[model samples]
Target: MASFKTVMKSGHPPTLFAAFLYFDFCFAIWVLNGAMGPFITETYKLTPAQTGFMISLPILAGAIMRFPLGILAQYIGRKNAAITEMSVIILAMIYGFFFVSSYNDVLAMGVLLGIAGASFGVALSLGSGWFPPEHKGLAMGIAGAGNSGTVLAVLFAPPLAQAYGWQAVYGFAGAVMVIPLIVMIILAKEPPDSEHQSFKEHISCLFTKDGWAFSLIYVITFGGFIGLSNFLPTFFYEQFAVTKVEAGRLTMLAAFMGSGIRIVGGYFADRIGGIAVLSVVLLAAIGSFLALTSTPSLAVTTILFMLCFAALGAGNGALFQLVPLRYPTNTAVSGSMIGEIGALGGAILPNVMGFSKQYTGAFATGFVVYAVFAAVVLGCLFLWQKKWVGAWVGPRGKVIDPTPAQLQAAGRLEPIAA
Candidate 1:
């Protein structure tokens, strides 16, 4: 509460509020196909693999677009970059609403929707740059809370599709986009002192160890959260013989846990440290995924899924909290690259679930695979903590403010080219 007050005290409330709305509505469109999976699948007679690939296209497309969007945010400014991104989404929704008549048409729409997903770096930077470092975790968490848009999609899209046809969902999405567009025009502004690093320097981050590490972690955390959210409707529908609307209702509960509680995750990351919070989160995820391996009853599966989403949601907050601290001078670039890389999880995980089902007649193998991978990452993060402890203010318990020479010596700083 105090941190939030401190954040609001130092930043523009209108800009932050606009950033949240921009992210919220865009996110709803970003995952729309997943929410409408049953309708789309039934309409196209899509196989499990095709359905997985179709839902994953937007994620893959977003990943491909994010690096450029990240750089664009640096050059054009986050606000302008956001405007461009939203416009694409609106137009794509319009096309989906009126003209999408074939499977290929739907795939094209997914590519355009990737622009909305690419908004992550720009949207976060738009709000996060307005605040001081100490308040960054909570500020970003509050902004990132926009992920809750998943709940709205799952809750509304299925019923809307049932009543008005799945394609009508796009028209509604386009209409909603108008709300954020107007608000962004009225309120979104670049922070006065926000850094704008060179594109070459931003790209150079991809070669660094920290860059790769963050991306890998996000792959598991965000990938698991979003991938699972996207896949859950399908999982429930296929496994339990639930109606599309019923599956959506179930998926909404889990998505809500992941998206809504993320702010609390950031609060703890600010207090006890991001790495600390992530440590607990990853461990919990490992346990939950492992539990899912045993073919639990629907009741137990729901509990396990909720726990996994909770951990991933909180882990998302904690991870981003560490981002600015680790690469303070390159927040947008690092965030963009890390976000882009981590998003591969969204692209990859669903396919894994699909293939697992394709061959094994069950999704347990995918759960086990994720659990094993997360365990390996947990160990890596454990070692990373000791090395980064003296470098971060929140994690180290005091601001060390190490000199450039010291930072370089610790291998925690990269030389930016002029």
Candidate 2:
């Protein structure tokens, strides 16, 4: 087997440590409220709509900050930006414990936790930068799976809140985060090619058709993942009238499976192709959506989320496979843009589900919306086959050589690898 150092010079021991530490704190911050949501709602006497905001506001904050954070990574080294976010998350969590007095306090913490949410921007650019493209899927998959922070937070934080009081939960998080933050600062290094770009150049990348396509595809895959991540407890609460404890348990199960499966998805995207794997995952997600719409029994819902929706989990892994290939030279920019776009999906879908549940009283309508989005994605994959994919090649290598017209459109130079 090729050694890690052989495959990627940037994957130095120190930099890899930095990547893991940064993601650990960031993930903890993103899911902190979810873990504490039931307690906050009960304590504050917040309505369902307000509870929904308390759970989702962090995602919104994260989404809005991602673009700017992506731009920030370009100016500061990815390591600095990434570690600074972790430091900020530690502050946010501590502040919530010390300062949050009412529902407004929770809201304030959610907004501040956005700093943690934007960690994706840093992780996307920083982690992927540390490895050669050939190893990125699996390497980044493991790093991305730090999303298990949600699972960990929900698994531990809810129980912790029940035991020590919610204030202690925040305090514990703040204290726990400090270790990884220090490790990240000491171990992480800069990308050799960390070039700063002007805001115009960054925005210019966003304007391309490919960028929009990436955003749309990501919104569905990532949006659905995060939407369900935040809303799973709520969905269970409404559908089955389960206790909040039981609801968080169900969510924990799904999250564990979803996050654990990303490593497999990343491996396959490296072997089969990101598009091929994603195409199958999207179709499966459509089926899962239909299953979710019908409101099955408890055992069935668990199976639906953990077993059938495994594809959606895999799709998350598969999507990033396309990221590095899309811009080999500008991996940092491309990776960060993909993250910002993907994070946007995370922000929008939860809110959409919130309003849907508020007005219509069921998640069935949101199901249909996701189904339509999936179908459109499938159709576009077929229609654009000639342009998006005309050659058969596995992940990690085999860069696409553009035609003259394609060259002008992409505005990047890469050799064809077929």
Candidate 3:
């Protein structure tokens, strides 16, 4: 703790910036299919299942890679893990540009790009490991919010693809990422950890109650954020009968709010508290989700979209805040597990939405599913808050106040929960 404090006190602003970019690039790729997916679906003559699988493949690879990536980060250290992953992504995106000309080819590229997407797991552990419990919320929030790269994907890729072609857009992204990857490799440094755990012990944690709780909360926050970010543009195009340009514009605005609000969540977590903020935000998100229907009024729908994203984005920060509060000593393990599960949720939900669209022929059915899932998570939070938050201690060994009983039930109790 002393050593960690001394280095962090010295400032990790540069490392934080690099971490931010790492997240930005990974998220940008994670949802690449989001902006171009409709185009791909048309180009490939893909069935809904086929489209879902290809678009979500990166997410699945990212989920599977998380644990090994965590162990690798522990071995190579976070900075190197980041550099290697970013380098792999740059190479993958380039390959995608020139060689990917068929549905099978695009699927192959998506698999390779998963290397880029997996950086999220590495970054989450790395960012959380460096900061103290006191600063964890803000630190993780700023870095995690880089998922706004979804906005980057939507904002740039559509125009680029529309003009230069999708393949050309890949080339452009691949080129742009190289500069940041080089800068990150040179600038980011890992904070040190002395402890080691057996692989068996590390794997065992995933099945526990606490691990499940964190995973569930993360699904509500990150799952919803990623799933929606990935599929929202398509939703707008189908539902509102808007042009791709208008759809992309709306999607980008929501991603901006979602990504940007994470920092705000962090600041508040450092002050009034994570559980408090999380409670309000989750409730707001559930309401927004439920309120979102296929309404004729553009104004009502727009507010619902923005409000839903705002809550989900803030929830992303608050969940990480809860992670540090609950599992300070095991930030690497906790964060890795949390990220894996959250990303797995991301991979699954989009396809689920895709399937729902295929079957129901509308995004409203998908919205109902998201709303119900969020409500279930909210129920879990209430249960956890009631049964556990009072009994736990933070990484600093501080006795936190009794947070909402609902949160405790939601399984925010992880250093040992399940």
Give the Cα error of residue 202 in candidate 2, in Å.
3.7
| Candidate 3 weakest ten by summed lDDT | 406-415
Total backbone collisions for each predicted model: 0, 0, 19
Structural RMSD, model 3:
4.8
Q: Give all candidate RMSDs, comma-separated.
A: 2.6, 4.2, 4.8
lDDT of 2 by residue, 1-418 (tens): 4454564554664675567567756776687786677678779887667777778888888878877777777877788787677777777777888898878878888898777877775775676676766667766776677677777777777778878887678888888888877877777777664545466655555655555666677777766777677777767766788777787888889888877877678777766777777778888888988888888899898888885446767877777766665554455566667666777777666666767787888778877887888889877765544455643223322335446564333424332334
Question: Native-vs-model 2 lDDT?
Answer: 0.71
* Pairs in clash, predicted candidate 2: none
State the lDDT of candidate 3 residue by residue for 1-418, as single tens digits: 2343453564577787788888897788767877787677777787766776777787777777777777777666788888887777778788888898888888777777677667765676666566656677778888888888999998988888778877787788788888668877787777654246566544555655766787888888887888777777777776677877677778898888899999888767666667677788889987887787555466678778778888988888877777756554456666777888888887887788779778877556767787788888888877776544555533222326545663333323234533
Candidate 2 error regions (>4 Å)? 1-10, 196-199, 390-418
lDDT of each: 0.83, 0.71, 0.74
lDDT of model 2, residue 90 = 78
Candidate 3 similarity to native, TM-score: 0.88
For residue 94, give model 3's deviation from the true position in Å. Answer: 2.0
Give the candidates in order of lDDT, highest first.
1, 3, 2
For candidate 1, which ten residues in a row score worst on lDDT?
Answer: 391-400
Error of 2 at 126 (Å): 1.5
Ten contiguous residues with the weakest lDDT in model 2: 390-399
Question: In terms of lDDT, which candidate is stronger, 1 or 2?
Answer: 1
